[model samples]
Target: MVTLKLLLAISTIKQWHTLQIDINNAFLNGDLNEEVYMSLPKGLTVSLSSCADPPLVCKLHKSIYGLKQSSRQWYTTLSDALLSAGFKQSQADYTLFTKGQDDQFIALLVYVDDIIIAGPNLKLLHQLQHSLHARFKLKALGTLKYFLGFEIARSERGLFISQRQYTINLLEDTGYLGSKPAKTPMDPKLKLDNIQGEPLADPSQYRRLIGRLLYLTLSRPDITYSVHTLSQFMSAPRTTHLQAVHHLLRFLKGSPGQGLLYSSTSSLHLRAFSDSDWAACPLTRRSTTGFCVFIGDCLISWRTKKQPTISKSSAEAEYRALAATASELTWLQYILADLHIHSSTPAFIYCDNLSAVHIANNPTFHERTKHIELDCHFIRDKIKAGSIRLIPVRSSLQLADAFTKALSSTSLNSHISKMTVHDIHRPS
Candidate 1:
């Protein structure tokens, strides 16, 4: 609650003020665990002979932590309390509850037992909290300093999300804190082939290493591609592959605090960029397709992988990529519909390949597109129905370019600048 108030303070000047609230006796207040019974808590069970019946186990009239249904009962209790107090849950996030009008909105986010309270209208926040406090015990934790692992900092630019401390711990745990730095997470000159190299002496150790690296991807886009490549050889890893994995750890050492930073001033429109490099895999002769989805300014999801089928033409490769991206877009449309946050305009899809864009917008039978799979035709239907509109972007500005293939440092940095990252905090 304090953190949200702080966020409102940064964004709204004095127009918004937050109220800090803590639900007192939150767990104890809930009606709970009718099935639970205990022997008189160690002190009162000694005198059973005086009564007509043997000393009966004390019945639990309320919920306690160990019982299976404790969590459900507690949630139901809290939910009823809030609903009675003029609050309604958000359709998008079940954890979020809201009340009041647009500018005067009061919001509460519940985390298990802890609750965060926020509102631009301070008077409303307090009255709600006061009513709750009158019924239950409550404590106020002034301002949110840290929640859900990400450190909070509200400023002119926006809310900066980073995991500087967490990254540092990862470096230390992997024994890479003192390793020399590398310019990039991946070496552009290297080529990976699955030739079934010498197997690891002990496979469990390699599993542990990859497990840690996967978690690191949360903040490090630079490593995402390289980590993905190395992961393929987990079953039979060679010394060369192990060295490549070490190189990634060294890259982490140089910038242990780097992570994604989601800022406030970002576009809310649903836009996706899809691109594919034709016949990029030397061994398989398969193409690679990469796509990124963004909501407003915040990046929601991204993926890069080799396509299942070999494409005879570049247009074929791009059409396959479009099909993959279209599938993702369709899922997002349904998600938004559930939240009642439908796009005001048709969702925009940006692709650098004119051949693929033409195939999507028009259903004409060019000899090249005839061989494309039946699944690929569905994208054209979506375009004609006005669910997704395809737009042509110049090669240089194509954001999906990074995910499709390796690029020069200058080009790589340019593409990185277009990412959702707002800042990197090194724990200073």
Candidate 2:
């Protein structure tokens, strides 16, 4: 998803043309490296001279859909073909391949059989598509309108990507289409625990619901926190958890068309916000870490997860959150460099905790910080190297605050707006 966002960002910046293609019988194109045999079909018309006494089965020479090794074999074949075409595969993302440099550059992103090709040169892009068609059976999709369930709309302003169809189907499947719309996905005062209610008779249903919701989060950042909270009870879901899921479904019913928008007018500057909810979990008392990264005004990446260990203080928890954010920023830097987009200014990281910022800038370790793991000190090195600078902001202005914990309806909407999440299909 990060690669997809970067590709869109670069395309928007350069006003490049984008195309999509689908491979027909993709798995069957792979040539088998090992000998494998299968039984003959129901009807056999082989000559007696060619058949053994017991009749010999058929040997397979090509890949098949059901074979466990089919995907690997297909990937190997595709990678070899691209490499032979003077395209270099990205070390950070093997699925991404690039050719040429600067304005002449073209990129191809592969997701199994579906591929997205984008570049500044239209003629070269079409020529490469023809080349790929010659090697394999390709179905040309003139423009990249839809891929992997995401409906993409491109205009002079920018690109709008949504999953309205997917969300509608999910709502219909879960029987929430006719339900009342919810103002908020989750109640701020609601508290969920492992043993709060009776165990569900069939936990698989709950698991399935959670799985579908997980995929919806790809484009809908508004439900990220609520979904993350409900996902924790997947192992042993209770009645309360099921109710919470229904509440989320109601929220989706209100605005199923919401999605992410990438503005062409936005700048290319990188900034991030890091935050944590100290001891948010009632069962394990583990802190939840949340961070969101933006390239200019567009939100590219975000995460919400629980801490691996218990923190003695809120500053420690915040510092750990900063470490995670720094790691993501470092990877983003590498990706931007690969895309030939360099930033002269250092990336800025915002946190509401002053102590955490002090800890990152401080050279000497205090007695209270002796037990801190060496891995948590990664942000310090990044700060010293001038790769990223940490700044303290007020808690109310923190965009990641909604990710770490449930917020009031007003606060949630405020953060959502700041993150640039809304329904582009709707009127202003």
* TM-scores of all candidate predictions against the true structure: 0.71, 0.93
| Predicted structure 1, TM vs. truth | 0.71
Which residue pairs clash in candidate 1?
1-117, 2-143, 2-144, 3-144, 24-137, 24-138, 267-296, 267-297, 268-296
* Candidate 2 clash pair list: none
- Given candidate 2, what's the lDDT at residue 136? 87
Supply candidate 1's per-residue lDDT for 229. Answer: 71
lDDT by residue for model 2 (232-336), tens: 999999999999999999999999999888888888889999999899899999999999999988888888899999999999999999999999999989877
Tell me the deviation in Å of residue 267 in model 2. Answer: 1.2
Question: Cα RMSDs of all predictions?
Answer: 6.4, 3.9
C-alpha lDDT of residue 304 in model 1: 78
Residue-by-residue lDDT tens digits, candidate 1, 1-428? 22232233233322344445556443465433333434366565556667777746675656677878778877877888898988887554566677776566766778666776766666777677678777677776666545555565556655555566776787787787888977666778888776645667887767678777876665556666777677777777776777778788787777766544445565446788898989978878999888877666556667778899899988889888888888888876654453334566878889888988887878887776777778888898888888888999998998888777766667777877777554455444
Q: What is the alpha-carbon lDDT of model 2 when measured against the actual structure?
A: 0.88
Q: Which candidate is the best by lDDT?
A: 2
Highest TM-score scorer: 2
